[model samples]
Target: MTAIRDDGSERDRVLANGAVMAAGTVVSRMSGFVRSTLLAAALGAQLHADVFNIANTIPNMLYILLAGGIFNAVLVPQLVRAMRNDPDGGDAYTSRVITLAALFLAVVSVLLVLAAPWVMELLLDSRFSEPALAAQRDSAIDFARYCLPQVFFYGMFVLVGQVLNARGRFGPMMWAPIANNVISVAVLALYLVVFGPAQDVFGAFSADEELLLGLGSTLGIAAQFVILVPYLRSAGFRYRPRFDFRGTGLGHTLRLGVWTVLFVIVNQVAYTVVVRLASSGTASSADGTGYSIYSSTFLIVMVPHSVVTVSLATAILPRLSARAAEDDLPGLSRSLTDTLRSALAVVLPFALLLPVIATDLANVVWGHGAAAAHYELYAPSLALFGAGLAFFTVHYLMLRGFYALERTRTVFWIQCAVGGTNIVAALVLVRATDAEHTSPALVLAYSASYLVGAVISYAVLHRLVGGLRTARLVRFLVRAAIAAGLSTAAAAGTAYLLHRAAGDPHWVVAAVWVVVTTCVDVAVFVALARVLRLGEVTTVVDTILRRVRPRHVPS
Candidate 1:
């Protein structure tokens, strides 16, 4: 009975925290949609968008490649340990981390700025070197130079945000990205107002245009980092420059970080290959979509993961680490497995429904100005990404388990397989298709890669944890798939009938169809979940119900 009560309490705490982060993520994503839409409206979805998108994106890719893996996965557990074991409650360690990270980011950001031309040369394709496309490629390199400074801000934002997370402050980190989105929206809006939409989809941006878009992007990132400062202070993190890196346990953290750094190296290398391939997709064809379409659709597919799995895992990681610290493998396994089931209970439905709504969803997102004519190009990649996202959610959670166990080396090796699969598949798949099929092919590569990742990571973590309650997990997966399958069929049937009834409806009507279909899908899924008695489903549903249910007052 006590154990049941404890589980309930744990779930409630996790759900409450998850809810806050999810709400912030939802808002941030909605604003991000506006931002992406504006981007499409301004630049169209082909070479023009790809040039700016890829250039502005390099800083983030570099940041992640350099430090994000260690900061995100490795440091959280280490910070948790410091807080628990250190007499000063990890303040010195946290400060040292901040100081060292800031120094690293500053130096790396400077070098990256110097190497911007070379970086663009590596990431863009051979087609861009042609005389006709040389101007566009130069424009991309210019944009990268302006945008590389964002590496420092992005690293700091995430590093500080992780500090907050380690201190049991999660909402601020999730919420602070909204500031970045809002700034981006403003920047794009200003671009539209000043320069208007790009006249030629395949044209290069002028110098002035690059200045606004590139510098504006860096400004947004800086603002995002600034927004976290107050929150850091409020979270009781007083930042002092602790230069005494010796005898301060920094070496231990760095030792653990080596494999994680290698992990990100593999990840970023694969991504660089993808970018190179994607860049060629647009340059090789006048009207074909590439990096921009691939990235935007990928984000849409990741909405469930960003909202549900990430938030849930962030809130649960501290507890899992605590269990591991106590050497309670069974307890840690139980919590990890339970969290996995709960997350999949929410994510599976999204995977099934995405394809049904892909066309309409694309219309709603990219159907504006210069983008409207090509918005449909996003649908195939979008549809394929749903499978990828579901696979990635599983892989992501399994990595958290490994992190908790300080199994960074194992995670690195697993990521190598995933990354290798992505690079090989992308190289092979893209070779077989034209420009139009590029994004879809890449999506297939992504899905296939993570399927490999999910299987390997889960099996390894299961063994490491003595058992990840595999029988229970398999049963839940089977039942959830059944429920989600029926729900998807119902949703698809409704969509088909609605299409017949409305026959080439406008965006408003299409949106109405999506709403009605989603309603029916959820209703059927809930009914079936109840019938199947899936506790994970019941726990989430009942918790939501309890939140919205009316409460009687003292009167």
Candidate 2:
């Protein structure tokens, strides 16, 4: 392998690939929001929603706690290396990895299901154990029993997706989640037709409700995993399960995963604290907020990071791995630095606008069915999440750089600082706040944690990669901040006028404000990008124009 110079054609290939994944992510997220809205509408955005949401979320949280860090970050570089260096093109190694992971996930899923009550005890606040809330506690535990089986499916989906990503098939992982969302949407619609909107937002689910909601959630996750199997064949891997995992370089990969597992453990510990705190919000009061409000709004702010940074990072990881393999630290630094700038150019404006359009955005998404009365509850958390998402995008992409170099130990230490901060901050903040303000306080803690993460991740990765051009990165941040800040002001001003014109408006008016404000926001950002000669934004505009407009076809 050779050093990957940041040439125009190479950059275009990365951008084009990133764009394909981004497009898929865009559709998936839209569908996901639809599913979230349906859940909010059907369950209402309080304790009732928290029961289902918490139960459903535990499988994912547990999957990550158990094996997610290994599958997601550590193994990609290993897979890329195996594919390149192994005698039979890594197919044997890949099959063994998959087979072993499948067996592990299956065992863990069953164990989790059996341990459902204990799991709920660990994650739920003391309020759940109160005599008055016994029914709700039982309901949450029952849901956990039904949903714990999703652990197997979630692990397989991500494991399969990461395999595909290593083979340079980036679009499928991004697109496959739409299937889950679709299945969920259908289930939620069926529930609505059968049960209608939620009448008791603070009540426990009936047996029928548990069967439909919990099993339906698991089925969607199963479908998500099933959707990826065909992609394995398409990516030229015909998987025949290889159980011979004793004498290969598998130990090396596991050694790397040890640190990543510790990293994930720290992360999940912090999350468990936050979950318990957030759950206590709605459990302690009838007119209170909780996990559903926090998680859904987080999903909303994560769009920019999920679509832009994740896509870009996934597309570029193989290349970064190659650079590290070649010991081309300078090339790795330059490549990562460039990707960072491109990601921030898109992320910053969206982050800035979240505060500007938080209420409007919340209303458009959650302002229907049972949640309509409480849709406004999402605004403060939505506003606070922007900064966290921004900080996290940096930490996330920086980890890709470390993963490329197999620096999992370094990543673990950085995460310790981050997780330590989150746990302490969340415990303190949640103690001082009322139930209505629970989500926002939790978001503040989240932002502070990732702020520590962003600084340490960048600083550490910068040192490891030789130099990530600190001076250049600082300039990019300043320019992008100016561009995004101005654009947000424009959007905010337009939103103010729209509100003044439509006094005491309906959800429809809020929806309209979101659409119009977004347009004006982007238009202003484009003008500013050009005026400032920001290459990141200008290059994207040029690429878009080149594709959409009539071009000279030189034969």
Candidate 3:
């Protein structure tokens, strides 16, 4: 009974933490959407948009390539161990880690800036031909030069934010991005007011225009990093730069990080193919599909996963690390299973319903200013991405499981397989389809890669953990799929009727239909879950009720 009570308490704590993180994610994603909408309005989804999108994307790619993957996968377990066993509460170790990361990233950022032109040449599709796209190529390199410095700030932000997470402070990491988005939105808004939106070609961007987009975007990342400093202080962590890394077991951390670094390299190699294909499509035509629209659609599809799955995983990771440290395999397995179920309980329905409302949602979100012209292109990509949402979420959670076990090599190999599949699939699809249709095909490739990865990861993780309640998980997933299918049908039917009544796909009408259809979908899903006695759904409902209902205490 005591053990059971303890388990229940832990579950409650996890859910509460997850709720806080999810709330923060919701706000961050909303602000991020606003930022993207402003960007789409200002730039549109064309050659100009692709130049900025690809250039802006490089800093993040560099961060991941250099240190982001290592920092994320290895820090939690290392920090957890230090917090438990170190005499100075891991303060010195944390300081050393931060100093090392900062120094390395600063050098990397400077070099990347110097090499921006070459980097752009390598990353942009070869089809950008020297003669025809000279101006576009030059503009992309210019943007890359200004944006390359973000690598330092981006790396610092993740390192510091993960430190906070290790200390069981999750809200700051999730909320800090809101500041980034707000600043970006303001910058884009100013651009619209000052220079107006860029059209058709990259030749319109002057030196000042390039500076506004480039430096403004970098400023947001700097702000995001700066905001986390106070949170570290509040968490009782102070940055006293300790260079004495000789004795602190950072070597062990780096050993673990080696595989993580390889994992990211594989993932990025596959993404490089995607970037080339996506950017190449834009170069093929003045007005066509490219990275900007694909990225925008991806952002929308990732909202639920970011808000729910990421929150649950982040909240539960410390606990999983602790259990792994203790070598309590059974406890670790059970906790992971519970967290996965909780995440899927929310994610599955969202994934299924996303396709049903993709068109309406896309129109309402991106159908403004110059962006409305490309709504038809963006919506189908979003729907295709929706189909793979569940697989992506599952794959993400499974990788975290591997991280908890400190099995970075396993993850690296799995990523290799997934990345190889994605690149090959994307290449084949691009060849088979026209430039206009490549976005959805590429999106499908993204999903298929993850579906392969998730299945493999699940099977391997189940064995590593001794058992993952495979039979039970399979049963729950099957039932959830059925429930989600029914919910999607209901949402589609209701949305179709509303569309027919409205007679036009105005933003207002799309907005209303989306809300109504979503409400209907949730109602049907919950009703079916109740009829089926799905324990996961009941657990979530009970948790919500317990949080909302007032409790009476004796005076």
lDDT of 3 at 512: 84
Q: lDDT, candidate 3, residue 170?
A: 95
Model 2 TM-score, 2 decimals: 0.97
Q: Residues 1-555, candidate 1, lDDT per residue (tens digit)?
A: 012223557777887788889889999999999999999999999999999999988999999999999889999889988988899999999999999999999999999899888899999999888899988999999999999999899989999998899899999989999999999999999999999988999999899999999989999999989999898788887999988999999998999999999999999999999999998889889767699999999888878898889999999898888887888888888888888898999899889999999998888888887798898999999998988888998999999999998999999999999999999999999999898899999999999999999999999988888888899989999999999999999999999998887665677777788899889999999999999998888888777777668998996
lDDT of each candidate versus the true structure:
0.90, 0.90, 0.87
**Candidate 3 residue-wise lDDT, 275-317, digit = tens:** 9899878888755688988889989988888887888888889
Query: lDDT, candidate 2, residue 264?
Result: 98
Candidate 1, residue 318: Cα displacement in angstroms equals 0.9
Between 2 and 3, whose lDDT is larger? 2
Worst 10 residues of 3 by lDDT: 1-10
Clashes of 2: 0
Task: Write down the TM-score for model 1.
Answer: 0.97
Which digits, one per residue and each the tens of the lDDT, describe model 2 over residues 355-471?
A: 888988888889889998988899999998888888998899899999999999998999999999999999899889899988899999999999999999998887776788999
